[model samples]
Structure formats: structure tokens, C-alpha cells
Target: MKKMIFVLVYAITTLTIFSFGKAAENEQLSIALSGQYARKMTDASKKLEELDTAVKKTLLFNESDGSSKAREDIWRLSSDIKNSVSSLPLDQSFSTSWMNYLGRLGNYAKEADRVTDHNEYLRVMGQASKNLRAMADEWEVATTGMVSGKLAISDWTNRLDATKSGHDWSGMGTTVKQYTESDFPLTASESDSMKKKELRNMPDSEVTREEAVERFKKLFPSVSNEIIGVETSKSGSPYPFYHIRFAENQSIGYIDILEKGGHVLSFLSERPFGKEVLPFEDIQKKAEKFLADAEYKDLVYEEARENNTAWHMVYVRVEPRYGAKVFSDTIHLKVAKDIGSIVGLDASEYIRKENTHPQPITKKDWKKFFHANVQVVKEELAYVENERLEQRLVHYLTVTIDEHGVIGTYAVIIDTETSEVIKTERLQ
Candidate 1:
């Protein structure tokens, strides 16, 4: 009996260790894969910009003196864009239409190039340009929204298929206009179209594609290359922005500039980080300068995490009187380790601001509601969204629960005005 008992205890201990080891490894893998996906998304957006620029250059460069070289650029760019899209992390089925459209565009480019008469070429490209621009707008809405919002891959792919136009790169047959012109035109799903229709009505701001490109140039003077093209946010977004990308030499980047007062929503770039390492404070200061230059006002640094490769800095907006941190209004910057050049930024949530609320008339001692074994760790004033998605002032508390032998950590939120328990979330 004693031998059997010993064997059971040993087996249990070994299994627990093995299981936890696997769990930890899985967690590390998940994080690594997530980062990889983000990097791929950044690259894909860069390709899109290149393709957009090539198409536009073809149409316009020929305007004044009719340069054939500009038209010739599209064949190569179209092929490159198709390859880039194919290389994305998504299943091939999800991106098949993208390739289909490029094939058509490539053919169109060749056809445009072969035409001998300048007027004939102009007339042909004029019609093609409108279709190309509209579809380009469609793609912008898809790819640019990812870099902002820290959007999930599943959510991104789901939206990609929504309200999409059908064959021959037709803008309609669905959303943009009448589909009567498209060969074998088909309808966009009704449900998807309505969702997009709803998003189209959401009030943000608007800028022409030209204006968006100019903003990109003014904001990042270091990048002398032509602006790829402007992409719009997904149709499902409440607040949309124009996404613009650029590449120069070994460097590639993209910026999300909002139409709402033309704010810089976010930007990400992949390039050789400088070899020189600066102090953490200096790196943070460099990030701060970038934010200021982007016209992001009323922000204060909150915290930071540093690794060998980069420093991830966070900033949040604080309410003046109560000094409650508005957690939703956040700005994040990832600066290459000590290089001080910002490699990533996500301030999409900060673009839309909510009016500050006045102090609540009622205040309560929230501690009385907890069990006797519950020990209050820390509490603070904060602005957090309640169940209804309405922003509310609350006393956000960190508390520990000791029930018999087991211990647990939790975040408890209490509404200041009504003293109602807003929500409870387990930390561990």
C-alpha cells in the first residue's frame, strides 16, 4: 500500500510539471507567431502602396508629354503586388480575388502600353483609372485598418470578404456604382453591403487621395520616394482613416492619417535600426518628440517595457480635475532599442475623444462589500467603459481574495455616481 501511494504521488507531480512546461512553451509560441503576423501585415501594406503608386504614375506621368516609361512600370509593379498578396499569412482562398484583379490590371497595363495613338491611350486609361482607383480604395480600407486598432487576423479576413465587388475589377456589380459594365457582374452579399453602408455613414473626416499623400510627405521628409497610395479604413470601423505607405532604399513604412482634422493615427516602419544605443530616457524623449510632431496633444507618458530589440512605451490621457486615467485613450510607441527611431505606433484609439464627465454626487466605501478574507491591495480613480460601452468614472481597485487556502487576484470596478459594481475581472 505504501509503495502504491508513493508511485501515485510521483506520477501526479511529473504530469503537473510536464503539462505546465507545455503550456509555457505554447504561450511563447503564440506570442512569437503574433509578432510574425504583424510584421507580415506591415510588409503587405508596403507592397500595396507600391502598386497604387505605379498605377497612378502610369496614368498621370503620360498626361503632360505622354511618357511610355510610366505606363511600363505597371506590368512589373502589378506582378510584384500579386506576389506580395499571395505571400500573406492568410489562406489562399481568402486572397484569390486579389490575384484575379491584378491579373486583369496587368493585362490592362500591357494593352494601354501597346496603343500607338496618345489620345486613344488617354481615353482608354481614363476609364481604367477610375475602376483602378475605386478598387484601390477598396484595398486601402482592408489593409490599412490592420496596422491600426491592433486588429485581429480573423476579424481582418472576415471584413475583407464583405461588400467586395465581383469579376473584372468592377467597382459595381456592387458597392461603388452600377454593375452593368462588369463582365459577368454579380452582387455583393446584402448583409455585407448593409454593414458597409452603415459604416459609410459614420462621421469621421475626409481627405482626397492627393491630400493624404501630401500629408505623408510633409510628415516624413526623410522618405523621398513616391507615396504608394492612400487606403481607407474598413467599412465596419466607426472612425476611419486614410492609410498611406512609402519605401526608400532599404527602408519601408506606412502611416495611418485620419480624415478627422487630418490627425496622424499611427505609423509603422521596418528598417535598419541604428547601431548606437541611447539611454532609455532619451529613447522615450525621441518618441515624445515624434508624438508632438504628429500633433498629438494632451498626452503624458504612462509606462514602458524594454527588450534587447526595442522599447515599448505607453501613454494615456488623464482627466485634469480628478486625474483619472482614461485607459481607452492610449498611445503606444515601439522604438528600436536605443536607436531612438520609432519603428511602430498605435494611437488609433486616441483620435476620437470623449468629453470629460463631472464628479459624481455620490461616493461610497466599496470595501464593505468584499468578503472578510478579501484584502484590498490598491485602488485608483479611472475612466473605463461600462457594459453599455458608455465611458464612466469609476474607482478601479486591485484586490486579493484568500478563500481558505487558494489565493486569487482580481480587478474590481465601481461606478462613482451610483456606487454600483461595474465589473469584476480575474487577473490570475
Candidate 2:
């Protein structure tokens, strides 16, 4: 009788524990299904709807006619869409497809930022917008039903599977190719091609590390005097540079200087700013003074915009003889809004087009070279750079034409003497 009682007690204890464990699991799952996770799903669906609408608007506006602000908005919306898609709770099969699509969309938006063509932008945006709208509609239906207790998460799972089966996502690969082709250090083949095709021989910078250190000191007079460290490396590029670390306001600051020329390529500071004290005009003056001190003279600011933290600017070299803008010789810089100090300088593009002297005819010849296809509205003399870093003297004509009831603006680059079309790019 004692052995039978012990066996019965063990059985009862095991059953009780098992039943409690099952109940706790059910409760936790109930919380997950109804609370934060469910709300996140709904939010994600709404963001998708916003993205679809944004893309539709972008499709309607030709890139050539859209303002810079419009392009910025589109870029921001594309980023939001990518983030929303990433937050979705999809299984492996669907997640992979959706991520690939989002990757393409992000890349398309990035490329569109740099002189996007009208027909190309329209084509890409149309397809992507249509697909996204369809996905958003489906997501809304599933999310609404799930929240109302009419649909299960598993039902959404089946819909995702169906979506994946319907779309052929194999052609949509990652954006690795676009990254490789953009402005970056050249590969072996690319370098060889560039060397073979270059109009002028590329010069090498041979400045010593000590000279670079002094240059950095001169560039940032406000920084602490003591240098923490100095190192040099090829940086996997054709050029070598010195990476210098210094102290600024008890914070670690750094700068990269080209080894050949002792030019400050970039700089960074960990110090945070409290408020903006100097106006934009003052900031521009400071930047001009700094550039003048560094011997980068006669620069024309091609573009300037202010963000939350700094003034982003693009300065181009001007041809002194002809008084024309040499757009190929460009430098990018940023002025911190709070301190009105130079925070960044990128002269890589200028360095790439070394010794590019374009010999062009008089400005009056511009009208003679204008093609019959495009009605030239405005013409200016500017040095244009091609893909292989080759510079051409061209009559840059900003022209407008009607394309299937849509008006489009384009920059037509006509060769100086030959009157042949060098290239054409859309102007946003």
C-alpha cells in the first residue's frame, strides 16, 4: 500500500507541473499576439502605405523638372520604406524577396539623386510603385483582419508565401555592382583602363609625414597643440595618406592628409556644439579665408545647403582666362554651424583631374554648336569630365523638350570645335 501511494503522488506532481508550464506558455503567447508586436505590425503596414504614395508622386513628377527639395523628400521616403520593410516579420522565403526589392529601390533612389534621366527614372519608379501599392493593399487587409480577431498570424504567413510565389525576385540582386562602379578607389583593371585612356598624366603626391602634420596644425588653429599620434598608409587606393590624431577640447580629433601633396583631405572632431553663433555669410567668408590660406583660390560655390549641423557646399574651380566655371575641378566641404569652423574637406575630384587645361573657342560659338533636336535655353562654357576622368571643353546648354506631353530639362554637352555631342544629362 505504501509503494502504490508513493507512485500516485509522483504521477500527480508531474501532471500538475506540466499543466502549469502549458498555461504559462499560452499566456506569454497571448501577450505577444495582442500587444507591442501586433502594434508594430500595424505601424509597419502604415509606413508601407506612405512609401507607396511617395513613389507614386515621384513617378508623376519627371526628375528633370523636380526641385532639389522634391528629390530630397523622395530620398527620405525611400529610406523610410527600406526601414519599414526590414521591420516586417516575414519568414525566410518572403524576407529574402522583400529585402532584395527594397535594396533595388534604395539604389534606384541614390542613383536618381545624381542627374537622373527622365525616361529611366519614370520607368523604374512606375514598376516599383505599382508593386509596392499592391503589397501595401494586401498588407492593410491582413493587418486589419488580424487586429480585429478575424485572422491569425498564420493566415498572413500563407499570404506572404503567395506573394513570394507570384513575384520573380531572382533577377533583383543586391546593390554590390552599383557600389563598385561609383566614385571609389579604382581596381586593377579600372586603373589600367584609366591610365591608358587618361588625357593627361596623373601626378603623385610626395609630401613627408612631418610636413602633413604641420599642414594639419595650420588648418585647425583652434585645436590643441599636442599631437597624439601620426600614421601613414596607402589606404588601398592609388594614393598614400597620413592619418593624424590630435586633441581638441579634451576630445580626440583626427585628419587625413594626402602623402604626396600634404593636402588635408578630411577632418573629424568629437566635440559637440551647443548653438549656432555665426551667420551663413560669415561661415562662407571663413571657409573662403581658409581655402585662400590653403592656396585653393578663385573657387565658385556651385551649390550650398544647410543641414541641422553644418553647411554642406560644393566649390568648383574657375578658369581665370575665360571667366568660366571648371565644373570638373570640384571640391566638397562642410562648415560646422555651431562654431563656424571647417569640419570636412574633400578635394579628391579636383586631384583626379590634374593639369586639365581645356582650350575652347569663344562663347559666341556656343549658339553655332546647338543641335536641332534640343531647343537651347541657356548656354555657358564649362569643362565637363567623362566617366574615365577625361576632361572636355564644351558649350553646356540647358535645354528643354517635350517628351510624350511631359516637359524635360537637360544639360547638353557639345564638343567645342567639332560640334559633336559629348554627353547629355538631366538637370533636377
Candidate 3:
């Protein structure tokens, strides 16, 4: 216990020193990202440990049904690692290959569904879990490098982002390719095909490739001339898109435009965002204008977060007549804080055909649903999805509850049709 206490104090002391020491004094270095690096390292370590444990359990299980929980844990942890790895200032050369590895791990977790050879699955997953541990260690070293300023600042931050390589997972081929056909990652080929199947009912392609290019140019007129090439997606894929690539003037990225509606399905622009950044309000305005320019309508935001170089935000579409927010139909945006440029966008959720929900037969009384001591602070109508992906109108409640002595605020969703508390999420 004494040793544990001493180690905890030492870790905290080291972090404080790093935050206020010579590294913080460096003009070109970012203290926020340096601090964030420590967090990402810790997260990676925990996730890798969980993933390895889950993989070990799966290898011992006699039947696939018996290992369902462990398999889900493997997939979830791999996804968590993939997201954490994305925040780092990854070297461009290693980013693609690393993502490919993470993706294959997720597919391997579900290989039982396809009746893949159990021996091969056991071998590949065991090795993959070990690889994750090593990767986590390397990331920990990189985090230290960031805080110590031992490596040249330009080496990590020269290009703003080394991530966001897009759907071109051609080079992310894995050694375990022969073990399972679903070895492709979630962001790569397999998930795309699956998602496309889910969205198979989307309107047919009527917009020409030339028209898609014009749309892309209009959305980012400044870098339109920098566009080098545009390629078409697979015919078998649902909602075929034109993958447009652009580079030059520090902006190297791609935009995927649907061939049917010329809608900007998704886009990612990678470039340096130096130490200076605009205020959050300005960033919000910039993102709003870009969405407006894209002709997206009736979107409203409730929160935004700063993610080092960019501000991540989600806006839900509201039904004009009912004023109920449709949580299923949403748009996610990422705006670079440096110049408020729309660096990333994903409107795939919005593009899906609207699912109808049963209209509220009657509004439920909040007082009856809550405990006597609970105080309702706010309430609104919302359309939330159920376990089966079916939509249902619900009473979105924000309330304060005092338990013994402590008070907590929570957001509760009550199904209007049955007056049952379906979900409860702590807001603070």
C-alpha cells in the first residue's frame, strides 16, 4: 500500500512537471495535446489488457455460443482502441497499416459466425491480442516523447493528421487474410458492404460523375483546383459514391460524394492547425455555415467538444410539425479550431429514409413516473430508437434527484405509449 501510494504520487508529480516545465514553455508545442497524450496512453493500455483477456477466453471456449460475451468484448475493445489511436499525431507511414490491423481484429472476433477453422481463429486472434499489447507500449513511448519534447516537434505535428485515410483499405492487407473472409475492418470493405446492404433502398444513381465533382468543388471551392482524381465505388455496394482526392497547400484529403443525389456522404481534410485556435463560438458558427452551404436543413445542436485540433459536434434533425428531435436522423461535423475549416463530416445517418414512429396517443405525467423527491427541471418530446431499430416517441426528461445527501442530474427517456422509463443517462 505504501509503495502504491508513492507510485501514484510520483505519476501525478511527473504529469504536473510535464505540464508546467520546459515543454510547456516551447512556443510550437501544444500543452493540451501533450496532456491528452498521457490520457490516450492510459486508455490504450486498459483497452489492450481487456482485449487480450477476452481473446484468451475465446480460445478456450468449446462452442461459439459459450464465448459470445468474450467475443463481443474483443470487438468492443478493438473499436475503443481504434478510436483512441486516431487522436494521436501518428506518423503518416504507419497510420494505414495500424488501422488495418485493428480492423482485422474486429472481424476475427466474429469469425465464428462464418464457421471459420477454429484452430486458425485461435492462432490469429492470440497473435493479434499480443500485437495490441506491443502497439499500446509503442504509443506509451510516443506519449512520453510528446511531453518530453525529445523528438523534433515537426516530426509529430508537421502534418495535422496522419489518420483519416478513407475507404481505400487496399494496402491494409493482413497476414491472416486466409483465415476469414470478413477480415476487413469496420471502416474498410466489410462494414461498408454491410452498411450498404442496410441502406439498399436508397434512391438509384441519377447524378453523373461530372455533377458529383461540381458538388465537391462547390463545397470546398478553395481547394477545388487541388483535386487530383475521382474514383467510383463498387457496383455491388449500396449507394455508390465518387471518391474525390485533393492535395496541395497543406490540405491533403478526400471527399466521398454519392452518385445518386450528389450529396456529400462524407469528407476529411487533413492539414496543420498550429497553436492558435478560434473560440468555440466562432468554430460553431463556421460549422453551421458549412452545413447551411451544403443545403442541410432543420438541424439543431445541443453540445460540442474540443478534440485538440478540431471541434466535434452532433446535431439532430427535428420534426417541424411535432418539434420532437429525431435522434436517429443526425449529422456529425468536425471543424478545425485553427481556421474553423470543416475538416470532417458524416451525414450518412441523415441520408437514410426516415423511419416512421407511432404518434403519441397521450402525454404521460412526469410526476407519476418519478419518485416523490425528484424534481423535473425540463422536459421535451423526442423520437428515440428501440432495441430493434424501431422508432418510438418518448418523453425526454431532465431531472434532479437527491439520494440520502447527494444530488444528481439525469436525462431519462420514457416511452409515451407505455409510460415506462426506457433509458436513463446521467448528464452530470
Candidate 4:
């Protein structure tokens, strides 16, 4: 019996030892496979890093003797990196940011290859570098987490700063900043006012349509010589303007003013394909009728005009109804040209229903959509002309949404007498 008991104990010990050994072997196999996969991924990443550096160098400096080859190589490297990274387990933040940066870089490289405008190409490349730095930071964080190792934040930060310094040294960032400062100086409100003044004061011409076409050719060399037709006279203005159309892909239409010393008054581009066309007046009538038919009892039309691309814009105000919340709301209608119909309408502030709660939304409502820490920086009022029966009272307000972000300006037009909103236009 003693011998039998000893044998049973020995058998149990041997089985236990065999099970433990098998588990150890499986773990070792997994570790080996993981290491091999990691090495392969690291090699691909190294190649991508090298390609990225070469592309940046070529873009920053006008280096030749294989710059085109480098550009093509970078595009292929980015694509390969995308495919490889997709197979790896990347979190949303890292995957999204890296893919976006790669896409932007690829686009920049393509543009650089075709671009004759050196300055524009440099500006695009500088932006690409900024985006890349952001992606690299995200990548470092993700890699550290995946390896379960602590990474030095300063290391990543310093690398990004160094890359930015290289861009600065090449004068790429400065060139882009200078170009932007010079090209886009005026505010949207100022631009709109200038366009309106130019249109209103355009002189009428007694010159024949043929003479008008010749004058237009001399004025605008960019547009091809193609006369679609001409309108002798229009109701809104006393002077006659020629309606000239161009080739399909070129500008859609242009108004050649014979009265305004034979100058091309305005040009319009084709709308996104398959859009209808509607006249300016017809759009205004439709908006007014829509508000009138609704419960908005006091619908007032403040301004209506034809914008670029032959789109008509109508600004109107709807007074608050009793037992309905909201003091007033502004409405804008975008009308299509092919048919006298409303293509788009924005009436966010003007929703009114009879059975709804009766108090107007206050500061709390505004806070829901706007940040609490917004700083009001500047304000300006539109010019007031007492002689004109139809006048606009516009308030230009500039505010900063966050502590460090672009200053946003908004144009708030109000009816002075009723304190009703006429229109709200966002400007950057």
C-alpha cells in the first residue's frame, strides 16, 4: 500500500510539471512572434521618417539634382506608411491625426511638383510642416503607451520646435505670413461695402454692344472673347449692361457696363453643377411670402440684393408672436437662377409655434451656443444715410472665443426703430 501511494504522488507531480512547461513554451513563442512583427514595423517607420525629412528639405530650399525623384519617393513612402499603420493597432487620436497629416503632405508634394508660383508652394509646405509636427507628437505619445514605457514629453516638444525652427530659417513661415497680411487686408464688411458702391455708381453707356465688347476685352485680358447675348436696358438701373457669357468651364457670365465708361462691372461664376437660376427680385418675394404665410404677423423686408454668381439674398425680420418665445428672428434666402425658386433658407432664430412656451430665450440660451469666456474686443457701426428711405444699421462686433485663437468678427444688422435683427453675417 505504501509503494502504491508513493507512485500516485509521483504521477501527479510529473503531470503538473509537464503542464507548466507547455505554458512557458507557448509564452516564449508569442514573445518571439511579437518581436519579429515589431522589428518589421520599426524598419518601415524608419524608411518613412527618412523620406519625410528629404521631402521637407527639398520643399524648403530650391535644391535640384533629384528633387523630383525625392518628391515621388515621399508620396510612395506616405502611402506605404498609411497601409502599414492601418494594420497596426492605433487609437483614434493617433490614427486620425497621422492620416490627416500624411494626406496634407501628399497633396503639398503634388502641388509643389506642378506649381510655378514659388511663394504659394512654400506657404503650402510650411503649413504641411506644422501639421506634421502635430502628428509626430501624437505618434510619440501613442508609441510610448503601446510599449508601456514612459516617454519624455520634452523630447517630443523639442523635436517639434526644431522642425519649426528649420521652417523659419528657410523663411517659409515668414513669407506665408507676409503674403497673407498683404493679400487679405480688408474685412468682409468693408469688401461688401466696396462692391456695393462700385455696382451702384457704375455709369451707363450709349456705346453700341460691339464697342462694349471691345472695351471689356481691353479691360479684362483673362476672360476669352465670347458674347452670349446683351440686355438693352434693365429695370433696377437706368444704364444698359451687356450680359456676356464665356466658355463652359470659364466664368459663367459678366456684366459689361457701357455707361460706366465701358468697364466690366461684375463677373459671375457657375454654381455647383446642377443648380437652378432665379432672379433677384423673385427670391425676395418668395422669402417675404414664406414669412407672411407663417405665424410671423409683422414680417418686414429690410434689404434685398443680387450677390455674386447671380444668387439673390433677401434679409427680413419676423416679430415675436404672443405665447411664442423669441423677440425677433432674421431670415436669409438663397435663390437659384434656372427657376424662380428658393434653393436654401437659413432661419435658425425665427422658429415660432403657437403652442410653445411664451418667454424669449435670454442670456442662458446665448451661453449654450457661445463660450462663456468670450472677450469683446471692438465694435463699429455702419454709416447712416437719412435721405435714403431704405437704410441699414449694421454693428460690427469682434470677439475672441478662446484665450489663444483667431479674433472672429460678426456683422449684426438691426432695425433701429424696432430693435429687430435684420441679418447676421460671420466674418473671419
Candidate 5:
């Protein structure tokens, strides 16, 4: 009887030990998976940021000065990013939202090469980027917590398929308030005409295709020998240019230069910008110098905005005669805040309208056009396009006016040609 009892006791003990060991092994496996999931989510978030940058490039360059290959690449990258998202462990809601967003993004990107007045696509892309950034932050926090033993891996995994009840889906910005799939800003066919619109900007000087390629080589010596293609710009394009491409060491680069002056309209390389080490002023100076060397000395810095790890500066042509800002003759330069490198340049507008001259309107002359009851507070020269799509020189006036019982500040644009009030926009 004593031997039988000992055998029973030993069997029970062994079984308990085996079960505990199995549970521990499963826990470790779950933790490893959670880490991998977080990493992929971070990667997807990064791809989305790249997509946002491509969209901004489209906005800045478009058909007027952008390359067809660049537009095509945007489509390709979005597709690749969508595939990346699919590899993530998402539930019905998350997967459905992302898929829908990527599908619409790919469709919009197909015909977004042209310049147009409508910018609904860009606005929507900005919202999507914001949501992706938030998701990445949340994942990072969860991963850090789990690895440090502050969180349970099992708990994190559960949320992959099921979000907590009462969470707002609209905050994700990819779905409607009710989480329906049909609430995208742009319909499939709405931007079709915009995609087909053609914009042309004539360059200040004309150069041969050979000369354009040589100019690009000088700008990027490291890849000069790797030139593979130099295609001509299509008809309806404002300036004649050579679309040059270089492929080396598994990386590719692209540049568009005028066939006349050999001026570069745009440039892009596949290399990543490194860490941010320099201040904004230092980076801005570098960009300014780049524009100066490129023969854009007459342009004045208007504003600088940052996105996708780069600072993009918008420069406007200063009217040589009137001291007015020719906003229509613009240029865009992108400085990689990381490593303080000038990574992009778009001078299509400056090339097209650099010689534009605006008539002068003195301070006293502007008063003759002001409304009788309006009080002028500030004034500046501005080049604006009218409703008729005609570029005009105007005085951008800030004024105070009483509208119905409310005092408001307004911005009024007066056409310098006819001294007529063209438009008034509320400032406050």
C-alpha cells in the first residue's frame, strides 16, 4: 500500500510540472510575436509617411513641372504599402479601413500628375498620415511596456482582433462616423479631368537634350556614369526638358532639366536622409544658396513648412520694378532636416514666369480704390490669379469693416490694372 501511494504522488507532481512548463513556453512565444507585430506596424507607418511625401511632391510639381515616372512611382509605392499593411495581423475593422484607404489612394494617384485647382486628394492624404502616425506611437508604447514586463502579451494580442467597446472609429480618419466604407472625400471620377489637365512652364533658356544630361551629371557626379535613360518631355508640357534617370548599386535617381537653359526642374534620389543634426536656420541657408547657384537669385523666401522629415521652402519672385511679390512665379526647395541636405528642387514656376513684370501701385493710389467706410490697416503687393484664370498684379490690403453689427478684419485684393476691388476674404 505504501509503494502504490508513492507512485500516485510522483505521477501527479510530474504532470503539474509539465503543465507549468508548457504555459511558460507559450507565454514566451506570444511575447516574441507581439514584438514582431509591432515592428511590422512601424514599417507600415513609415511607408505611409513616404506615401504622404510623394503626394506632396505631386502637389508641388504636378503636370506643370512633375515627371510621369514620378507619378507612376507614387502609384507603385502605395500599392507596395498596401501589401505591407495586409501582412499585419488586423481585424475586420482595421483591415477593412486600411484596405479602403489604400484602394482610394491608389486610384487617386493614378491621374494626379497634372496641376489643378482642386486639392481634395492632398487633404485626405494628410488625414490618413496623421492617423498612421498615431497608430505607430500606440504600438511602440505597447511593445515597450510588454518587453519591460509592465504589460501582458496576451492582452495586447487580444486587441489585434477586437478594439475596446465605445472607441471612436472616426478618429482613425479612414472611415465615416458610422465606420461605413463609402465616406471618402473624392469620388473615383471626380478628379479625372484634373488628372488630364495639362500645364506648361517655359524655361528661361533652351538647351539640347545632351546639354541637359550634362548639367544633371554635374549636379550629381556620383551617379553620372550610371545614366540609363534621358526621355523628352511630352507635348503640352510648358518647357522642353530631358527626363534623366540613373540606376546604380540597386538604387535609382531621377531629374528633369530644361532643354533650353539646362536648368533643373526637379530631382530625386532613393537614398534616405540621415539624422537631424543642424538647426532650421542653417538648413534654410543651405537651401537659399542652392537656389542662388541655380540662378534663382531674384526669388525671396515666402514660407517654410515641414513634412515627411523634410523642410520645404516656398520662394516667390520679387518684382524688380514694383517691390511686389510675384507669388505666381514660385519655386519650391526641399531640405532634408536630417543631415541638412538639399534633397529636392522644383523651379517650374520660376522658369515659366520669371520675366513677368507687374505695374506699380503706390500707397496713395491704393487708397483711391478702398471702400468709403472701410479703414485700411495694412497693405502689401501681391501677384494673384483672378477668377478668370488670369495672373494679375494686385494690392493685398488688410482692412477693418463693419458687417452687420460686427467689426471684422478682412483681406481685400485690388487689381492694379483697373484699380478695381477684385476680392475680399475674411481674416477673422
Candidate 6:
């Protein structure tokens, strides 16, 4: 009886020890996985930053050297992201979805690198950037449990499909939005007919294609090569235009000339003078010069694109010098890059006259007009217009309050020329 009792006691003690050891081992494994995940994320973020810097340099300089550097940077970043994602443990709950998103991003970067045409490259890159930003946002939400990680993967793939589908390459504006949304991908006969219509409606002063080319050559002696292309509207509208791409060695530029009666509506080039190619800094300077006399405050440069027609969409605060204050009376200037001239400025938002001056008494004003704890995080300016020709320059200011509260945003617009308060609205 004593021997049996001793054996039973020993067995119980050994089993207890084995259970504790197994639990400790499992906890260590979990900790290691978390650390690995964090490292991979950090590496991915660093690579992304590098890729962005390279892209900005290429767009701003438009130099062969910059382009080459950007290409290499993109390739390296893609490879690193891919490898980092692959290194993640297969048992990770989010691993499969994250891997899919990274793969799609890699495909976009690869496609962008293959594009030799400057305009095409810009268009592709723009689309890719949008997709990347979306993916990043989705990832954040998924990790925070605001959205499902699996859903994020599906959404990214859908966006990729939307971007990769090719439509008509020719027509006005090499922008993907313009082409994909239009009745582009038209038949050859349809394209020819559209050309005929353009020629018929053109004014007599318009020069022929050959004549325009001759004039352009005289103006830009360095133009070693030229390619002609046509642009069609997405809705099959009668608005179609011809484009000319100029090249000097590895440097390239573009000019958009209306085909209607062959008039040169706009001449643009992405290439900058001297050693610089596409100098965004210079572009910003030009924009600033153009807005010097305007009464607007908080002037901002945003949404610049270098496509067949290098264009910059600038958003500035419109503080009216006199009259009622409107917050977001924005001005949209379409600048011609070839000549560095403003081709069009749309300020239709100011046409709808509104007096935004605070009334003597308002119910909301009495309840603390401003939140003291809120801190501004981000602000964006844009142009908004109504049918009554009333244009409002809009300023969107986002703020973060206490950790428990949602972010708040304020939208304000002002007059275009005379900076005056037009209106202010808040959102949370």
C-alpha cells in the first residue's frame, strides 16, 4: 500500500510540471510573433517613404537622372515590401490579406516602371498612388477593428482592376479620369468621324496640323522629336483635341492644341529651363505670383499633375477685402506649361453672392463658439460653385479633440477676387 501511494504522488507532480512548461512556451511564441510583426511594419513604412521621395523628385525635376533614380527606388521598395510580408508567420490572422494587398501594390509599381512615355507614366503613377493611399488607410482601419482585414484585401483588388482596364489613350487630357469615364475606346471609324467634326467646327484662323508644328518648332528649337495624338471626351461629347509631345534626348514635354480649325488653345511643357526639368518649386512660385494681388489668405498649392498638359490645381482662402465673408471661394487656374501662362481661371463660386457675416444673435453662438481642447491636425482648401454663378473658395480644417471624441472639420469659403467671408460650416 505504501509503494502504490508513492507512485501516484510522483505521477501527479510530473504532469503538473509539464503543463506549466507548455504554457510558458506558448506565451514566448506569441511574444516573438508580435515582435516580428512590428519589425516588418517598420521596414515597410520606411520603404514607402523612400519610394515617395523618389517619385516627388522625378516629377519635380523631370530629368533623366531623376527618372532613373525613381525607377530604381520603386523596384527596391516593391521588393522589400514583398519580402517583408512573406517573412511573416503563416499562422498570423492578418497575414493572408496583407500579402494580397502587397502583391497588388507591387504589380502597380512594376507597371508604372515599364511605361516609357512620360505622360503615360504620370497617369499610371497617379492611379497607383491613389490605390496605395487607399490600401494604407484600409490597413489602418482593419488593424484597429474598424473594418475587416479580409474586406480590405477585396477592395484593393477591385480598385486595381478599375485602374488597369485600358480605354481610349488619345483625346483631350491624358488623365485617367477623363479617358476611363468617357466614351473612349471608340472604334477607328468613330475617331476619324470625330476628327472631321472638329475640323468642320474650327474657326478659319486655326492653323493646319503641319502649320502648327512648324510654328511650334520655331518657338522651341530644342524639340528633336514630336508625336501627335488625339483626345476624346468620355461622354462622346463633341469636344476632342490634338496633342503634341516634344522630346530632346531623354527630356520630354507636351503641348495641347485644339484641333477645331487648328487653333492653339494651350501650349504646355513639363520640362523646366536649364538643368531642371519639371520644377514644382518654380510652378508654385508662378502660382504665388499670379495670386499676389488677391485678398485671399492661407494660399495653398495642391493637386498638381504633369500629363500631356502639365496642370496645377491651386486652392487658396478667399478673404474678401470688402463685403460679406465667404470661406471657400476657390480659384481653379489651368496653366499652360509650354509658355508658363494661365490658360483658364474659373471663379464661378463667387458669383452667388452671400453675406457670411455673423448675425447679431444666433442660438449656436451662445454655447461656446469654439472648443478649447480641440487641436488642428489637417487643413485642405478647394473651390466650390453653385448653379447661380455663386463661387465659394472652401477651406477644410480638421481638428482632433480629446481621445474619446471624433475628429472635427470646419469648411469655409470666401470671395475669389475680394477676399470676404462667404460662409462657414462645421462637421464632426
Best by lDDT: 3
Instruction: Return the TM-score for candidate 5, rounded to 2 decimals.
Output: 0.45
lDDT (0 to 1) per candidate: 0.67, 0.66, 0.72, 0.49, 0.66, 0.48
Compared with the true structure, model 4 gives a TM-score of 0.31
> What lDDT score goes with residue 253 in model 1?
83
Residue-by-residue lDDT tens digits, candidate 2, 1-428: 99999999999999999999998888678656655446766766766766677667666665444634444555666566556556655545444555556555655555475543677667667766666776666656545755565545555556546756333322222222232233123434346446533322446647887788788878777773778889887556555678888876654678888776676667777667658467988989888888888888878878788888888889998777667777866788888888788877777656554344557574454445554555778877777765434466778888987878887899888767556577888977
Which has the better TM-score: candidate 2, or candidate 4?
2
Superposing all C-alpha atoms, what RMSD in Å does each candidate have to the true structure? 24.0, 13.9, 15.1, 28.5, 17.2, 23.2
User: Per-residue lDDT for 370-393 in model 6, tens only?
Assistant: 467756565444344432234344
User: Lowest-lDDT window of 10 residues in candidate 4?
Assistant: 352-361
Ranking according to lDDT, highest score first: 3, 1, 2, 5, 4, 6
The residue pairs in collision within model 3 are none
* Top TM-score model: 3
Q: Identify the superior model by lDDT, candidate 3 or candidate 6.
A: 3
**What stretches of model 2 exceed 4 Å from their correct place?**
1-205, 224-226, 234-237, 250-252, 357-378, 387-389, 399-410, 420-428
Candidate number with the higher lDDT (4 or 6): 4
Off by over 4 Å in 3: 1-197, 403-407
In candidate 6, position 281 carries an lDDT of 62
Candidate 2, after superposition: displacement of residue 220 in Å? 1.0
